[model samples]
Target chain A: MNLILLSPNDLLTDNRACIKNPRQLAHIKQVHGATVGDQLKVGLINGNLGIGLVTELNDTAIYLDVDLHQAPPRALPLTLVLGLPRPKMMRRILQTVATLGVKQLHLINSYRVEKSYWQTPFLEAENIREQLILGLEQGCDTHLPEVHLHKRFKPFVEDELPAIVADTRALVAHPYTETACPCQIEYSLTLAVGPEGGFIPYEIDLLEKCNFEAVQVGERIMRVETAVPYLLGRLF
Target chain B: MNLILLSPNDLLTDNRACIKNPRQLAHIKQVHGATVGDQLKVGLINGNLGIGLVTELNDTAIYLDVDLHQAPPRALPLTLVLGLPRPKMMRRILQTVATLGVKQLHLINSYRVEKSYWQTPFLEAENIREQLILGLEQGCDTHLPEVHLHKRFKPFVEDELPAIVADTRALVAHPYTETACPCQIEYSLTLAVGPEGGFIPYEIDLLEKCNFEAVQVGERIMRVETAVPYLLGRLF
Candidate 1:
């Protein structure tokens, strides 16, 4: 972990926190190879970003004198509405989105999305939180992304999506579009990316009515994971 | 697989190919749901972009009446010199690079690169080729990226790198650099990306001596895989 992310539950005093979890403890010992008095990058969940001086480092736990002062890095002014990827791809996408500083993510169903993907246990609240934590640690940020799952496409887009796209520049990454995606855009944006084979003609029509302008990345088709970072990097 | 990539061995005649491998056969049946007379996108390894019409589909194999016509997508006018990623990340990087149309890649050693990463079986020729094939299928491109390995750093930089960077825009992704990475460069470019923890000062100095300008991506840190596509998207 690049940053040692702490929870409110880990707080022991006004400026002290104890990490009892094996995951962070083992990482501190093995990956960081940390010793006492080392000022490690530490951040509180949804709080501040600062440093934690390692006071006690043991195999079981580590105690830190926490001092959070600076604000976390700015979150991307974007909301990602992505088609639910297959089980294996889902884990990495969650982490990638979080690391890319996405504050809001909506994983919705599409025509090509497998039915069994929704059945995946990896979509559990705890599992999603765990991966997002890992991503936050990687990106050295504190804000946790709020993930919303939509099992039905039509209802979510027809009922809920318009509001999300109301004030933002709504976009969908479509291969066949004549409009190329704009770059270095700083305004609020809501980007919709689809599953492999992309959204069907009818689904694109629905999204168009919702005010999402289809933009092509390039002639070369990219996998969802690759496309996400590519599009994010270009847009902001 | 988006495009069914065919090997020379799969060719039965001038305009015919048979896919007997369970991997492609299963994908054809399950993913494409192919039937006789259905034409699917197909590409020949290191050859042409074309189409294959299914003439026979059964339990063991799927025979295709092939028609080779169109040229493959243009290859990126770039040479990527990257620090050897961790074994698990290595597989995905190879695939991502190839899918993005990179035809030249050099995996080299750096001070931060773990010594054991040089010993991974995934670096073996056959294994690397497999991932490249999968990438070509996803990209709908025919050319495979040529990968070169450098076990030692100083020699590779001093002896070989100058010639490779001679006629190209040479850049190294350094976090501490004052130069920001350029965008949409149509010229040939050589980009060097470091492993996690990044290249040490000594290594960066040597690279500078080899004519590589140090350019920064941004303030936020990204994993090598995410950074690869992100950088490629911006440069192209």
Candidate 2:
């Protein structure tokens, strides 16, 4: 973990907190090999970046004298509208989105998205939060990305996506598109990426009607996990 | 599998081939749902991209009338020098490197790289080829990336890295560096990325002596897997 993320529950006072989670405890002890009096990079969730002075180091808990000041890394000026991926892939994508500093993510249905994917327990609020927290820890950030799910494709695209695309550079990643994906864009963007086989023609048409221009990266097809970082890196 | 990749052994004649591998057979039958007379995208290993007309299909094999004429997707003009990742992560990174169209990859040792990483069976030629094939299939490309292993760091940087970075834009991903990574560069590049905790100062100094300019992506620290693609996307 790059940063020791603190939740309100861990607080003993405004300036003090304790880390008791076994996973975090194990990481701090084993990976970091930290000890009492050693200062660690830390941040409060949805708050500011700072340091935690290790006041007490024990097997059960690591008490920190907290100090908060600096802001987290800048959030990407982009909204990701992704086709709900397969259950196995969804877990990593959640972490990736947050790690890349994307603040807004919408998991929407698409023709190529399997119905079974929507049924995965990984979509549970607590499970989703766990993955995002891992991402936040890896990225060393404080603000969490907001994830919204849309089970229905039509209503989401027709009624909701328009406003999301209103002032942004709306884009949909499609292999068949003649236009190459733009690079190093300065404006905010709403990027839609499809499922494995890609969004069907009718689905593309629906997205196009919402003012989303289809763009292709290259001839090579990349999996969603790779594409997410690839697109973000290229655009930003 | 996006493309049925054929090795020389699979070719029965100049115009015909048979896929006897159970994995390929299952994917063709189940995923592609191909039958006699069905044409599927196919590519010769390290050769051209074309179509294969299914002429015979059975439990044991699928025969194809192969016709290769078109060239594969353009290869990225990059030579990746990466610190050998953890074994589990190595498998995925190999596939990702090929999928992204990098043709030359050198997995070198770094201060942070665990000694056990170089001992992974996944580094074996046949096993590495298997992963690269899966990547080519996923990417719909024909050319397989060449992977080289460097068990020693100092020698590789002093003896080999200089020549590799001679003409190309040489960059090392260092979080401590002040220069932001450049994007949309229309030139060949040689990029060096470190393992999990990153290369030590002494290692970075050696790289700098070899004319490698260190650059940072942003504030957030990405995992090696994420950083590989992120660096490639930004640089190219």
Candidate 3:
């Protein structure tokens, strides 16, 4: 963990805290290799960044006293609309978009998306939250990105997407499109990416109606997971 | 697996090829859901894309008759020089660069790289090849990228970088730098990325001596793996 993330409720009386969780303890010992008196970068989950001093340590647990002052890390002014990828690729996409600090993510269904993918265990709310937390820890951030799921494309586009694109610049990544994806983006952007085979023509039309401009990265196609980081890099 | 990748040696024999490996079988069953008479996209390792007909399937094995006539996917005119990242991130980086069809990848030592990272199991030749195949399968491409390791930064910069940079547009990504990464690259380009904490000033200077121009993607500091796809997106 690049930053040790703690929740506000974790603090105990007298500003002391004890962590007995196997996951957190393993991180402290195996990842950080922390010892007593070692000050580590810490952040309150959804709160603030701070420093934590390892006041006590043992095989099963560790204790820390924190001094929180800095504000939460600023999120990128970008929202990603992804056609839910395969379960494995979805894991990487969730962690990556969270690390980059995207303000929101919409996992929408497209024609190319398999219906069974919606039932993958990785899409469970708890699992999604865990992946986001991992990304935040890696990026030294505290705030979590809001994730929304949409199963129907038409209702989402005709009802929800208009408002979503109202004040933001919307761009869709389609491999065979005419417009080239822009390089330097100085304003907030909403980027939409398709499933493994990409958005069908009708889907692209629907996105265009919602004000998303179709763009291409290059002639060579990329997987949905790779495209997420690539789009974030360009837009952010 | 988007495409089944086969080695050239696998094609010397004529009628039938048997694939009993768990990984390949699982991919065929789970990802492709292949059945008898199913024609799938197949690419010969270091060769061409072709059609594969699933001739038979049993409890432990799959048989296919492949036609290898189409040419291999074209590679992007890009070379990547990355400050060796942590091994976990390195695996993603290697797979990503290969998926994006980069011609070369250089993993160089930098100040922030942990010494122990060099010993990661993912760096083993077999493991690296596995990741490359994953990427090739994702992109429907067959050519493998050439990977180079440079432990001594100074010697590599002084001795080899000059010829490497000759007649190519070389750009290095460092956040907070002056120039913004350019869009619409139409020629062969080389992109350099740093480790987690980024390259020290001395290392950047040595790169400058080797005619590498420093560029920034944006003000946001991105992780190395994220930066790879982002850089490739902007450049290619």
Candidate 4:
């Protein structure tokens, strides 16, 4: 963990906090080998990032005298609308999106997305929160990315996605597209990426009707895991 | 597997080949559900990529009417010198580099690289080749990236790295640098990335002495896996 993240529940007072989670505790003790008086990077969720003076170190918990002031790094001016990748990739995607400072993520279903994916336990609030927190910790940021799931495709695209794309550059990653994905976009953008086999013809047509222009990354096919970072890096 | 990769021995004649490898056979039958007359994407190792006509399919083997013409996707004009990540990450890195069209990769030792990382069986030739083939299949590419290992840091930096960096834009990813990483460069590059905690000051000094300029990706610290794709996306 790059930053010691504190929730409101961890506060002993306005200035003092204790890390009780074993994950963070083990990381602080074993990975960091932190000692009392060590100044650590600490951030409050949706709050500020600053220094935490390690006041007490023990097996159970590490007490910190907190001073939070600095704002987190600027978030990406992008909203990712991705097909629900296989369950195995879900956790990593969550972490990656969070780490890259993506403020909004929408994992939606497509014709090619397996129905079993929606049933994954990783989608549970606490589990999703854990992955996002891990991602936030990695980025040393505090603002959590808002994740919205759309299990049905048509309604979400026809009713909801247009509004999301109204003020943003809307694009979809498709192999057959002649247009290349643009680089270093400075304004808000809503990008759609599909599942393993990609969005079907009907799905593509629907997206295009909603003002989402299809763009190709390259000639070579990439797994969603690789494609997400690749697209994010290129677009932002 | 997006492409069924073929080796020299797989060719039975100029126009025909049989896949005997159980791994590829199982994948072709199970994942692809291919039958006679199915046209599958196929590529020859270090050769060309094209379509293969499935001529025979059974439990014993699969036969293909081979046609090869198209060249593999252009490789990144980069020689990446990376600190050897832990064993679990090693396999994935090998796969990712190949998938991204990286031609040369050097896995080197560094201050923060655990001593045990170099001992991974995943570093073995057969094990590494398996991962590369999986990557090539995923990317529909023919050429496999060459992976080099450097068990000693100081010697590799002093004795060998100078020549590797001589004709390239020699760079080291260091967060302390003022220069942001250059983008859309068309020339050859040699980039060195340190392991988890990053290179110590002394090592950075040595790299600097060898004409390697330090460049920063961003403020958020990313895992080597994330950084490789991110930097590749930005630079190329």
Best by TM-score: 2
Give stretches of model 2 more than 4 Å off.
none
* Cα lDDT of model 2 by residue, B128-151, tens digit: 999999999999999999999999
Model 3: per-residue lDDT, tens digit, A67-129?
Answer: 888887678878889998998787878888888788699999889999999999998999998
Lowest summed lDDT across 10 adjacent residues in model 4 chain B is found at B217-226
For candidate 4, what is the interface RMSD? 1.0
Distance from true position, residue B138, model 4, in Å?
0.7
Which model, 2 or 4, shows the larger DockQ? 2
Q: Model 4 - which docking category?
A: medium
Q: Please report how far candidate 2 places residue A133 from its true position, in Å.
A: 0.6
Candidate with top DockQ is: 2
Q: Local error of candidate 2 at A134, Å?
A: 0.4
The lowest-lDDT stretch of 10 consecutive residues in candidate 1 chain A is A216-225
- For model 3, which pairs clash? none
The deviation in Å at residue B11 for candidate 1 is 2.5
Ten-residue segment with the worst summed lDDT in candidate 4 chain A?
A: A227-236
Chain B only, TM-score of each candidate: 0.98, 0.98, 0.94, 0.98
Error of 4 at B168 (Å): 1.4
Tens digits of per-residue lDDT, candidate 4, A1-236, equal 88988998988887899999999999988888899989999999998899999999888989999998899989998989999989998888899889889999999999999999999999998999999999999888899999999999999999999889988889999999899888877899999999998899999999999999999967778888888888877877
Give all candidates' CA lDDT scores: 0.91, 0.92, 0.82, 0.90
